[model samples]
Target chain A: MSQTRDELCWMTISEAAPLIKRRELSPVELTQAHLDRADAVDDRVKAFVTRIDDKAMAAARAAESEIASGHYRGPLHGIPVSLKDFYDTAGVRTTAMSKIFADRVPDEDCTVAASLKGAGTVLLGKVSMSEFGLRGHPTSLFSIPNNPWNLNRSCGQSSSGSAASLAAGVSMGSFGSDSGGSLRNPAHSVGIVGLKPTFGRVSRYGVIPCSHSMDTTGPMARSVADIAALLQATAGHDPHDPYSSKEPVPDYSANLNDGIKGLRIGVPRDYFFNKDGGADPETLDLAEQAIDVLEGLGAQVKEVTIPSVADVRASQGVIMISEAFAYHRQFLRDRHDEYGPVKFRFMLGALYTAEDYLQAQLLRSRICREVAEVFEQVDIIATPSMPRPASVQGDMGHPFSSLGGLNFLVVFNATGHPAISVPCGFTGEGMPVGLQLAARPFQEAALLTAANAYQQSTDWHTKHPVL
Target chain B: MAEHPLPSHDELDARLKGAGIQLSNEELEFFRGAYPEFLDQLKLLYSYDVTGEAYPFDVALFQEPQ
Candidate 1:
């Protein structure tokens, strides 16, 4: 067995699981390896907000004992994973990165966290995030997690720590929630795979709310297969979650290697790509190259117009701001100083008039209908994940700073579609670029299938940031 | 590309005050100047015809059966 640190640290969950199942690698050994790696890299990266070493080691020992006693839980059985701070862990601090709830410890684990533990995974710790998962940058009042690729660059997120931790090899996989590009943006910036599953696919019960309607918790990993494995372990209907759907959860890993031949992929040239001065040239180039790869794999690619994506963004923003304000109104009013400036001012200042909020919801229905029509023609839509490459913290403005009055990822959030960001290429400075894919609501299986096909055809996702 | 009318700075400031969001004079001016563009951009949502369908904004509290 290779005893090299890089070999052990960089192995994907898919690779690690089989080894653990074969008894070739004990759960205790794997858990210790990651804890040691975290100790080495975490200070610089600040990926984890809370380190639960003793609890994790105990769980690993239990897993080892169970496997030895001929009781195997599943694929996740010894896999080390991290949870975003927004996830509620019973008896553990689940601060949403805001001082208002800094001492708040839930009495029950979030559905996703409980599900992963039930599947026998060991939780490494809670990853850092934006304040209340409210903003997109690392300027939260709490300790901001630095991007691993460039210590000074913004990791692009509410899931800032999840991306950083995965890039730093602190965990094989992690959980992240997306309201507006929270998952995709960081994944794009940090060069990892992040999925925003269909809104009701993963139970959000116990996860802190950002936008009640748009928040989705999903897996972030280094590879498509690893994400699929984590997704399989995390997704299912839970009765406690009012919005949880009884929709069947498919076996994501079994069909991942299915080729993209004969699949119809639509390129929304006008809305996503050809919009005036929208995406940077390198991003556009990478996306076009990804499309070429899909075409090469026997996918029928066609240019389709997605009417009024800008309108979708606006409506989504209104709903997001209004809903967020409603959720945090008391906190904002009572604990005003506890919130970060950007999120505080933005949330408080943007409380939409009842008329504006209602109109936004009505408009959301229209945008969703329009997108639904587009999905009827294409099995999935592909575009650049972000308009540009990751920028150094000072070089770039605030993460939520608008680019010509548009929020790139909010449109899909408004439509409640399942979207993902997969690393497609790198910029001149070696920063990662991402290609985004969106499928109609509840079509995550198709989206993952297509993404898996793309992963097999290219080495893009294989490239990791050299920390 | 269609032209849309937006509320002026004074109108926006007055509206903010009416809405009970207390802002300092400087903050009021700043937001007033910012409002026209913000309103213009937000008006873009009116371009789409989403009138009757249910908006997808429901929240989930727990993952167990209620």
Candidate 2:
């Protein structure tokens, strides 16, 4: 049976790979189907800053020829994927969704982008992102991408376009940067899977930096298996990225279905559930129910605490803004007026005393130590991805609003642990809430294994928003 | 630092200007209005009691090289 363009567009990379290898689905045909769907829905979703229609088509044709010749790269070989605008693409304008770099086109690709291209994935285009992943428009200035579930609400930040595109079936998979919650935040809001591998798991060679210390490049897709596939293709040591880990990359796809049986799951109940005003009551309930699902699956669930929970947010804020300011000091000095109000607030990094910045780092080191000890007692840790689902579009409250948005997710970034967000359930209003699972540093295999098992037991990841 | 001390607007504006960054009259005014709330959040770091600890520099702080 021939699948319709709609069906073809929504097929996960895991589902499409075998079909392409078997010659039952032509890469060109699949790519054309996604391109057609993107053309139809992107006007409403506004998920792309630049659409590389011709280039994507050409690459699809090349992939189809290679497969037809009995050569297949892998799961991502012919997948139609996109990147956040901040990742520099050779010969493509890498604006980071800001006017400052509007005319700038890079001559080289970021290592992650280049690696995906090397794997024979079709480059659909550059998706929108918050300017430099912080300080600029809440949504892209190109257009605010609307959440597929509720057009009036946000999809989520930094990776807004990537999530919106995946949710609306405009793209099958994509990559996003996270120093804070940029990757999982959007994944949570859009009801998809996003994995922030250990900080050095993926290279940051050409991806723009918001915080050098915490910046992590990660994969976002509709399924845990798909995220595993993407991570498998991208994770490794890179000579160009000094911070890239020398740790041997593990095969994430092989162990995905291994299930979470016999694993120790730490709930972080008191600390995470009540820290910083906690998540909305229903969001907390959904998280608890998700833990119960794991318990039913033979996983041992226990309450654990990582000291200085509140301090994670505060320290992350200071270090991130300080590093971001260091990166953007020249721009802030020369083109102050070009930045949005959000940027003005963040660029106030200039106002932080050097002592404050250093003190925050010291606190980060202490918190990291405390969290490592907690991990020694549990195989994995789980928490809600956010306090609530997507807020109303452009409703970013006051400029000085509490940085509580990062309360649930930033600790992992601080500790450089591998974390993944899987859809746990929906709010009464039908927006999605995410259950975040973090494993020990560089243990993404265990993290993805747990997430994939939880996804298998629940239908949350399979539920899509009707546009 | 006090648990939640307010930053002076005049002092903040002077600091931003002193750093060689120019803000429009409107931008300066907005920063003046928002400085207090921002400081309130920043002050949360001071309450952490992070004495004698070194800054976290590398991911090896948690894991051994494999």
Candidate 3:
């Protein structure tokens, strides 16, 4: 590996970990390289909200000393990473990019933050998110981060800064929340790999709540291997979160090169590829090409359907807003003026009847059952992460304008399944398109295995935005 | 089924206030513009007419990992 600073900033964690572990590369040097690159390029992306430059350097130096003493913690030891602003870091301000919580700081780290720190990763500080992770709000309190690939286009939210930072090479890994496509949408928009692990696989102990039932925390990185390494560090049960699953954690990075031979990959054409629900022709073509790549890897492919996709989309919206309102009702009542335009989103929840909320939950249950039936037949399901490329600012039409719009990504949130968006191909405009794969609950290993196999066969994940 | 009449602006406003939310005229206008689509989605969810016991939990909630 070359020793250039620019190259060091972009090296995936999988590549940097072994060298850092063997004492061939200095953790301080690697962290400093990324911090310098972030200083140079983050102005264009506005990816970070509070960069703890001194703290990051201090932690990197400590990691270096530990490794030099032959105490390498793991793959993440000395690795630089960013947290989406929603995750609480003790003694650090953890605003969700909203003025409402602008002065808020926590006394404890979130479970995932603690897990990463315990794994010896260096924190690069908090990144921006949509106002309280609600979409359709004016980003008045924070800078609207630009897509590294095309600054003029919107880096889809609410994990906008997380994906933007990774694509810009400001951070090697990032963790973002996804209630309704927050992680995967931006990953699709920015051409990175985003994983939304099974709902309970990772704890949300201290992260700001968006939709309790739907919200999940997961990793976004440049490749499947990097995502696996990051997940290996942060995933597992924490007793603090009531919703956290007790499932045993597995080593996500151990089977990356196992290949997808004899695996079953399902493609649901009615909802994901049809003219009514699929993305534009070019985007769909790219997704189809990704499927072909999977087929070329000796995987058996077939068509399948998870029923009531439209109903799931509608129910997810209702439940998400209602749950969010449940959390923010007091703030909206007292400090309405302090909120960004997202107050409109929170207020809409007030209109839903208690029955409406229950009905949405019932529909969610039905959708989960439907998806489970599909998973019984297919090991993994693949679809276009988004029906279109990155939409320009102020031009995001209604969510219904395209097939793969937010609907395709939100279904998994409703079903509580694990899903990931891997860069499949780029449009003629050079915008990235993502092929999303989802598996049964706790089947993230299968999902990652298939995605890693596909990524191994394609070069799309290697293409970075020329920032 | 009987027609589920949509709420009037006054009714919506009262409901919001009942929930401890009062919007200014501008914010009221923003809510007015955004709430209809949300209402339509609620209607879509009700369109399915799901019956029997409705467990309002995610798939992982009740079941242990396999």
Q: Count the backbone clashes (under 3 Å) in each candidate.
A: 9, 1, 2
Tens digits of per-residue lDDT for model 2 on A294-313?
A: 99998999899887876687
List where candidate 2 sits over 4 angstroms from the true fold. Answer: A135-140, A275-278, A402-406, B1-8, B53-66
Best candidate per lDDT, number? 3
Instruction: For each candidate, report its DockQ versus the true two-chain complex.
Output: 0.30, 0.52, 0.57
| Model 2: reference contacts kept, as a fraction | 0.55
Return the TM-score for candidate 1, rounded to 2 decimals: 0.92
Evaluated against the true structure, the overall lDDT of model 3 is 0.85
**Candidate 3 local lDDT, A4-79, one digit each (tens):** 9888988899999999999999989998998999988988888999999899999999999999998989999999
User: lDDT tens string, model 1, A214-328?
Assistant: 8889999999888888889878888888777777778888878888888889888776675476668778888889999989999999988767675676777777777887777
Best by DockQ: 3
TM-score for chain A, prediction 2: 0.97
Better of 1 and 2 by TM-score: 2
What's the DockQ of model 3?
0.57
lDDT of 2 by residue, B1-66 (tens): 346454576777777877778877887777777676567666777777677757574446435465
Q: Which ten contiguous residues of candidate 2 chain A have the minimum total lDDT? A: A135-144
